[model samples]
Target: MNWQRYYKFFNYLNIAEADYFATPEKATQAISTYNRALRMLKNNKDQTEAIKLIQTIADDYPMFPEPSHIYGIHLAEQGEYKEALEYLKRVSLLDITDEMANMLQEQFVVIERELKAERSSARTQTQKTKETPQNKKASLGSVLQKAPKHHNKESLSKSEINAINKKLGNEDPSDLSEEIARENRVSDRRFLISVFVVAVLVISIFYFVIRPAVVNRLDGGQTVNQLQWLENEITDRAKDDPEINKLLNDYLSEFSDESDK
Candidate 1:
């Protein structure tokens, strides 16, 4: 914050005389040095090094509020009110002069008001976001958009509302028609497959066990005693076969019919 803007003595000096003031060691000499360097910097159309050099002096002499105060005023002019307030506040604390103190205090009041207005505006925005339903819907829509494609589209679309419905174990009737019908079709196919497997098992059993016995009996390879022996064996093992009970019942009915004939 180089507060000292114009130097009457250095104004008329050439570039060579200005260089003599630019490099100085002490605080008083540094101020003169800064003013000369600043002019030289402006003449050369380069202010970057000038600002850095001024900043270094301000940092080196924290008690000297001149640099900070000037920098604060410069920042304030550039619309950096908060940063300006910081440097101006430093000047208020350190500089005991009534004019400088009063000036910094005035700037402080203005900057403080601006900061408070900014904070209030931010709080109002936050409160409106909390109260608005549209914002909430927008946020939920964003979440649904990110969801995987395999997930039910209808479920994601109504996710916010469905969350409450899910807790009560309530289902949407509109969804049941398609979903239930599809489930029923799958279940019917599974049932038919199970019946086919059972039929294969039954045929295998009949071919391996019942057919051999029946063939032997028909060929007269087994006498009446041997046929009876086979029948007794089947009867004894009937409980082990799922189809045996029904088969025995049918066989008994046929035998009775033949005897009647």
Candidate 2:
């Protein structure tokens, strides 16, 4: 069985099975399986099984939009926004309905906003924590600088001497500062790792999954609507991430030349 036909039907275009598939019986069977998965998803008792079934379908039929869409929604509802966004972005490569497209766009906006807010809050808290020790050190230094250098020991009140000793006995400000800096470094490392993982995932999906489908479509001399959608998505995303713009633009230029022919 030529699975590419099924891939094109579910990914590139939403055409009738009779017109799109060489074997209508196989297509019908796939659709039946998809429906069964959907029904399982609707049943609260079968949710875990439903997700496994959907994931199996997705793996078997790479780039099939419906399973990705369902899984994306499920992930979002579970508060796993980053993974949800990735799955939804995959769905955008397919010929999904306008409703699905709209939902994808909304999810993108929400996830981006959530991530931005989280980063902002973390930075603010870190900054405040880092400043606190510095401010205390500065205040202590100012007090020492203004103190009389030659004051007679007996001239100091007992309360004043006790206060000075109490301040000195507290945890060392330098030690606290060092700990905060260490924590910041660890946080920075973790953030960089997260970014690297996400980047690798995006690159892998583009190279291993989407790239093959695109080459297959081009070889078949099919419409370039899906490619156009991808170009537009990249264009919009490039506004926020300039790093990937040049690579994607270069590829799109090649696609444009081929489509023109």
Candidate 3:
């Protein structure tokens, strides 16, 4: 079933608006649909229907400010001037481009004029609410603007500003103390890190280079070699003793003669 067309035909707002906002091209199609709905409503005097489509136009594609402004103008056309102003004000606050802002500003001027005309004529001196025709619902904003001057100043009084200051009080010194404590903790960490790195360097030198060299000497790297040389010197010194020389020569000569024969 072609749900979009069917839903649109029967004014099924929820169902018909689904796939219309899936992508940019689809958003364009949706915008066109919204435009058509607006035109049809204006021609047929269906203000309620037009507002619904205008709402959908902004809702479905909020990234584009064009739809938002158009929707606002449509709302204003339907005598929902306050709501229209809110939508346009939101567009301005959203950092929309200058061109769109200017266009909407012009449109607002026209709507504001229309609203002023209606609010001035909506009430009777008999305190009776005079019925407004299609486009004269007394724009709430315009009525408030044109209402008799009220003296309640918008600016805060000096006492009120002082009261606000008293309510705020001074910033707690405890927070500053806590911040200082945090900085001290960070400094402690840095000191510990430096100490740990130096300790590792010292330990590495001892184990890999210093300890190994000491171990080599103690385990007979050069000590045993020097002992052998000393032994040869002692034997040479002993040869000068007559008895020791006779005994060494007799034993060696006997062993040598036995081996030869």
Candidate 4:
């Protein structure tokens, strides 16, 4: 009466001795007895056992119609319509009884229709998502973000201009362009003023500090040379006249004594 236990015992025996189920008649008889016991079960354990037993039979005898038909219906009950459809379609092609084949064919058609509807609904939702302006805008942003690094300065400027235009919405681009131009002009003027101030400082240092020191050194050298030439001329004239020489010597000695003091 415990069909699940009965199926499990036979399943284990068959595994231990593959020759036990070597004959088609023996396999068919075991499957039929298992199905009868499964119908008697009325508990949760029975439901679980039924699923396992049916799946095992389907796998063991892939060409068997009864097991495949039941397994397909079980899968359909579990909301696995696509998988159920495949098994049921296989059963229909296995040359089973006309009544059983017709039943499986009906189930297959219903599952196929449901799958088609689900696919259609999904496609419609996808199309709507693609057509949305928000999605389109996001896609545009993605493309711009993915732009290559080879872009030139002019392209960058144009992109900036376009971004500004978008941000301003209905405002004039010319006004913004003019404003930027004015700011640039101010920056240029500040730069020029800085250069001019530095140049003036350099010129002032050269004239007042460097130039004065150089001129003083040149004048000192010229004066020393002229004094030496005058002293030489006086010595020559003194040698020719004794009185003049004495007078000149006395004056020179006095000058030297004064200079020493």
Candidate 5:
């Protein structure tokens, strides 16, 4: 829907301007346009136009409930009630599936029987135009009355304030001022707890793990150095004779094996 895109842009404009209601009137207009187009296309019987609009709407908004509902409505008028029922089943118009869709199915049944009755009673049933739109309010007036007031509270009605207050749990206006403060307090507490956990983990690793491992490596290195010094002393003493040199080699080999273990 072009109206849908325009409505999204309206939201962006409100956010960008920081007005929050920058395009409130325009947004209402867009919604009215979208709804009007949906209703018109639902009733319009021109098949080519109907097909093109329905396809466009469905292509643009596959997830919406209206496009498929209208397709079913058109199919129903064209005597494809079963297929119509399939598509109509997807929508919740007037809670149609509960009692609404059945209204359509019942109508179809009555029409089918009426066609039989027409054959028997030939000129019996009378049809006439029906009045709709009971208790209708002016569109502009309704929009103005129902739209939220982002303006000052002095301009807000008791009903408007009450509606707004319900969403905020009937709290004082002063509490509304502190809404962001509440969120900040929660975030600060959560951040502090997370920092404390991380610091504890780091400190535990340094004290219980890294420090002990460093001490063990230093002790093992000293033992290796002492073993090497003992081997050098034995070698110097054995350098005077060949037999002693062979014995010294075998003894040092045994010491090397023991040190490695």
Candidate 6:
């Protein structure tokens, strides 16, 4: 059977004869819940409950795309880009209208731009951190180069040594070396921390954003089998209802003939 045609036919039937199937009531409830959540967001109220409600509706009613779309938008507005991308990706898997598809594409672009900006910022920070220690080392070298030059002598006189130590805040030369080493260590630690944070963001973007799209593309046959199973279940449930059984048989026969041709 042509799974796309079967899905579209059922979808049209559900919309045209809302009272005949259970989907109309569910859709109504989903819309009501979504509207309530939207009001909470617009009023600037505490959004904890509102977020929870929308998330629940999105999970429970996968056939409806609006809840997921709105949830993704909200997350994106809050700067939760990774989660927003994930929710929006879910919306793509559902039956969406042309307008919804356009909106979804815009959202994907926004999320991608944000992720790229974050990655750029992270790299800049890491570069600055790594440069700091080198700059400090250069400054220290310049200070040492200004030391008084003794003619053909490897060692400085006592007075000259005292002057040099006083210029260095009375710190011993060995202490100065240790202080520079400590500063370098601190800078290294900061650089490592920045690199770790950037790594985590890259991994999250790949897992939540890229991985789902690839998996969905590879699962076409699995999706068709799922639809077929749903059709069988509906047929089994309608065995005692002559009207529903007749309608199912008629559509099935019609589609089977089309598939043959």
Candidate whose TM-score is highest: 4
- Quote the positional error of residue 245 for candidate 3 in Å: 99
lDDT of 4 by residue, 47-143 (tens): 7677777677777777656666777776776767789888888777776666675666667677788789879999999989878988889999999
Report the C-alpha lDDT of model 2 over 81-191, residue by residue, as the tens digit: 788788888889877678778766876887788778878999999999999999999999999999888754586766676667668885545446778999999999999
Error of 3 at 59 (Å): 2.8
lDDT of 6 by residue, 1-261 (tens): 111121111121224332221367776666667667766655647578987887888778655576677777777877889998988898898766787787778778878998999999999999999999999999999988997777787587776786788887785666468679999999999999999999999999999999998888779878999979978976996788888788888878988999999
Indicate the TM-score of model 3: 0.30
Candidate 3: where are CA atoms >4 Å away? 1-53, 60-63, 123-261
How many backbone clashes can be found in candidate 1? 2
Model 5 TM-score is 0.28
**Lowest-lDDT window of 10 residues in candidate 1?**
3-12
Q: How high is the lDDT of residue 147 in model 4?
A: 83
| Total clashing pairs for each candidate | 2, 0, 0, 0, 1, 0
lDDT of 4 at 137: 94
Tell me the RMSD of model 1 versus the true structure: 18.8
Reference-based TM-score of each model:
0.40, 0.41, 0.30, 0.43, 0.28, 0.42
lDDT of 5 by residue, 199-239 (tens): 99999999999999998999999998997898787688778
Q: Sort by TM-score, best first.
A: 4, 6, 2, 1, 3, 5
Q: How far off is residue 234 in model 2, in Å?
A: 99
| lDDT score for residue 237 of model 1 | 74
Tens-digit lDDT track for model 3 on 151-187?
8865776657656666798444543587899999999
For model 4, what is the error of residue 128's alpha carbon versus the real structure, in angstroms, after optimal superposition? 16
lDDT of 4 at 258: 98
Clashes by residue pair, model 2: none
Residues 1-261, candidate 1: write the lDDT tens digits: 232342122232233432332343454566664675557544744555656665675666666555566566657656677887877776677634676666676667777887888889999999998888887898999999996787435655576666667678786676468888999999999999999999999999999999998998877854777868877877877889858867777777999899899
Stretches off by above 4 angstroms in model 4 are 1-37, 40-53, 73-89, 92-186, 208-210, 232-261
